[model samples]
Target: MTFPTPSSLVFRQLFESESSTFTYLIADRTHPNEAVLIDPVDSTVERDAKLIKELGLGLKFGLNTHCHADHITGTNLLRAKFPSMKSAISENAGSKADVLLKDNQTIEVGQFVLECRATPGHTDGCMSFLLKDQQQNPLAVFTGDALLIRGCGRTDFQQGSAASLYNSVHTRLFSLPDNVSVYPAHDYRGFTSSTIGEEKVHNPRLSKSADEFKTIMDNLNLPKPKLIDVAVPANINCGVH
Candidate 1:
């Protein structure tokens, strides 16, 4: 099925088998001429690029909300393909980006301008993108592992912290207009997304206080992700040396 996005954006979900990660490509629906790739994993980059070409959209930029631990980010590959395209990321990711993004930063993509919300928790530098329609209705927020549908990202790795995650969600994400949609970086069972209103009221993880959230998150007996050891270094170095 096709992905969900604001009325002025066209988004596609490309799955990477190695990590079950979803890479999204959003084009300005109004212009259909400008596009950006978000958290693109290396495995499916080529397939996604071909689709972008077929759609007749020019790749203008690529964004990595944060360093990924599940699969290699294809940012470098895409940057190479569209040499003029800027690789935009958080300012925290210094000395590497063609453009440094800051908290509450904004970027224009046709009729819609996505506002960056720095929701650090899953990783200290993690971020979420806020999409507003042409009329400026807050459409959705792309939570990059920091906030998931029913669950959240494990906090035992790279700049991850349970308390930080707790604050980030409640203060930064949950505080959004309930009508805003919640688009997570990953989800199992094919139920790819949820609305902020729904998550605030229904997410089991979000129901607890920060202290309780910390205690519970600290106890989760999750195993290290298979690709974490590989994907991280690759992503930190922009996919390669």
Candidate 2:
């Protein structure tokens, strides 16, 4: 689902590079004042804070697609700022998230409705948020780290699995409209975003079928994140780790 002009909701994309993570803010016009921040960056809360104030929007929600390994998330911080704002994450992800988003669960706020997709494999409860207008046509998807522009997320971290990622991508994310704009959790090479169709045609990983993806992911070796050990435990414990 592609749109001709601005989307039904107002969305802003931000990139934080201590770990190269991408954060997004999605809001609708009717409640143009109520906004949602996704996979917020801990190191850049002040920057986000600045943007929120500049945009003159009240943060209504904060979400994490999954527990992060490279950088701490600002989910708790944002919730603290907006005491009533709900913090969302997948169930049993060992998170302090307040709203446990389940598969196919829908959230209606103002003119936008977001559908929760239980896209695990990157982690036990990794999720992707599917957005649409009142018509239910596909608009955008915030794919935390489950999918990237030309590459899929690494499956070597805690709770990470090559097989799980393949299924999550092949069946879950890939099923969306090929033209849907993808906003990923991070991009290693600095390219901002890409569509699923673009990835399918150009992504080295997606060029292979499911079976081929599993085999290649299994044999490939990737270096651990520079701060994985330090970032993850803290992320799980509200920055206490």
Q: Say which candidate scores most in lDDT.
A: 1
Expressed as tens digits, the lDDT of each residue in 81-134 for candidate 1 is: 777778777777432667778998888878877899888877878888887777
Q: How does each model score on lDDT?
A: 0.79, 0.79
TM of each candidate vs. truth? 0.92, 0.92
Worst 10 residues of 2 by lDDT: 1-10
Candidate 1's C-alpha lDDT?
Answer: 0.79
Which regions of candidate 2 deviate over 4 angstroms?
1-8
Q: After superposition, how far is residue 43 of candidate 2 from its true place, in Å?
A: 1.0
Pairs with steric clashes in candidate 1: none
